[model samples]
Target chain A: MNNNTSIIVTSEKLNLQTCYDFVKDPSCGGIALFVGTVRNHSYQKEVTLLNFSSYSSMAVKEMTKIAEQAIASFDIYKIAIHHATGDLQIGDIPVIIAVSSAHRGAAFKACEYAIDTLKETVPIWKKEHFIDGQVWVNTHP
Target chain B: MKIKVLFFGIFTDIFGKTTIELEVPSPINVVELKAFIIKNNPKSTALHFAVALGETYADDNARIHEQQVVALIPPVSGG
Candidate 1:
């Protein structure tokens, strides 16, 4: 598939190098990448691990929209967004975003926009497992 | 019209299942469907959520049809 703008929702590990390489271009001077890893804690609770679930069809569709938006809103040449589903432990990479542009400013802006928009719009959910119990993140006030 | 409702995130916990079949009147919009779900599953009312008709994020006014895939999406936390 053309890597100019890729949206992936998978149960496999995310390779950062692959994302960086996908956005690499001879004409593009700058590339920005953002990696989201499962953290060890949340709100003072010790998180043991995380389990991610997604409405796969809608998640991919929404992610594609975010990438297209980033490309249109910024002077970016390419964008890649990958997200992992299923069980994940702390330090595991769950999401990766890469954007390339002719200049550093646009690349940075696009990269940030991609991730922020994904969190807000995508149909992916994370459940944080704690010692006492597990709770779905971002579902409460 | 009969539609398939797929629940995600905490909604699955609330409904005790991932997918459910609902029979509703024809010409029902998303707002009425949501109200029906909240009426039956009161626990779902606590979370902020949205509905997706097929693969598209739907507004409250979007119409739903028979056998259409409708998903209840709770606030997402994916990075």
Candidate 2:
């Protein structure tokens, strides 16, 4: 079942280069990586930080499904997914997705598609810590 | 039948706790379930949530399977 895919749930930070390296197999000539960091501002609010939480089991399952879908839909060889849980300070790497393909075009397109679709379909949620107040944000809309 | 419904984000903050179970005569369909939630918390009308039955997100026409866990994930504004 473990066919060169890395999907994990952890509060610890993510290593983008390591994720990229795993997908850097010789069979895949092109690689694309996307990182989602916690911005310090949301709709003009001074966001102090963010806290991310997810039902780990369900989240990992959903992410695995997403990776599988991407591989099926696009011509890609390798994929890696890492998401941070618990409290995350501003500018923290909350989500990371990297895809490798035979060509640059497919890699770029597939990588972008994965992240967008992941935001829509994944069960993860984030709580924004603003200077004055804090609020939880949902995935859709 | 009584089914526990989980709410997250704005829905959770308003409802308090992450889950709420309600007694209904039969299996609750997605539309009806949404109406029930909105009725219980009128202010939640502004919240747009996606219902999930376990790992699979429910569609608008989905019907809740008996005793299945349902989750209401409010519209997420996260990046």
Candidate 3:
């Protein structure tokens, strides 16, 4: 079912090299990668850390769907989407998306689509912890 | 019938646990189950949640069976 897509959701750290390698293909001439890090600030708050969590099985399924959609919509060769859960400190890598295609245009487009779709569909959530308190992202208005 | 309802993201924080086993007197649909949950814990009504049967999203009128795995998915924020 999952052909050239690598979809992972875990509490362990996300590895950029792994995703890059998975999407690397001999025929593909271009590779695009995206890495998401825990920012130090949000909404004028001095964020201390971030806590990420997910319904792992659903998240993986959703990510796989995104990868498949990117490949189908674009001329991509292979794709990988990986995300991390649990406590994340400032600058910690939380997510990574890599795409490879015969040309740079398709690679870049597919990479962007993968990340954007993941944010919308994957069952992962982030809690931003500030020096004062903590709040879940996208939870409230 | 009894089913285990899983909570993800902020639902975990609001519910104070990851999963809960709830009993339904009869075969319940997704909408009914959601109402049953909300009637018990009204605070959950504050945030919208999507229902999933196993790993797939379900319609409100979808019938839920005993011993099935259900999940209440809140808004996602992954990138």
Please tell me which predicted candidate would have the highest lDDT against the true structure: 1
Candidate 2 regions with alpha-carbon error over 4 angstroms: A1-4, B42-45, B77-79
Q: After superposition, how far is residue B79 of candidate 3 from its true place, in Å?
A: 1.9
Please give, for residues A1-141, the per-residue lDDT of candidate 1 as tens digits: 344788889999988999888899999999999999989989999999999999888888889888988887999999999999999999999999999999999999998888888888888999999999999889422
Tens-digit lDDT track for model 2 on A60-133?
88788878888888888888888888888888899888999988888888788878877886777888888788
If ranked by lDDT, best first, what sequence of candidates would result?
1, 3, 2
Local accuracy of candidate 2 as per-residue lDDT tens digits, B1-79: 7888777667667877887677755766888888777777746357577777776777888878767788887764433
| Candidate 3, pairs of clashing residues | none
* Cα misplacement distance, residue B78 of candidate 3 (Å): 1.6
Q: lDDT by residue for model 1 over B1-79, one digit each (tens)?
A: 8888888998889888999888887888989888777777746356467888767879899888888988888888888
Instruction: Output the better candidate (1/2) by DockQ.
Output: 1
Residue ranges of candidate 3 with Cα displaced over 4 Å: A139-141, B42-45
Error of 2 at A11 (Å): 2.3
Least accurate stretch of 10 residues (summed lDDT) in model 1 chain B? Answer: B39-48
Instruction: Give the better candidate number (1 or 3) by TM-score.
Output: 1
DockQ of candidate 1 compared with the true complex:
0.70
The alpha-carbon RMSD values of the candidates against the true structure, listed in the order shown, are 1.8, 2.1, 1.9
> Whose DockQ is greatest here?
1
lDDT of 1 at A12: 94
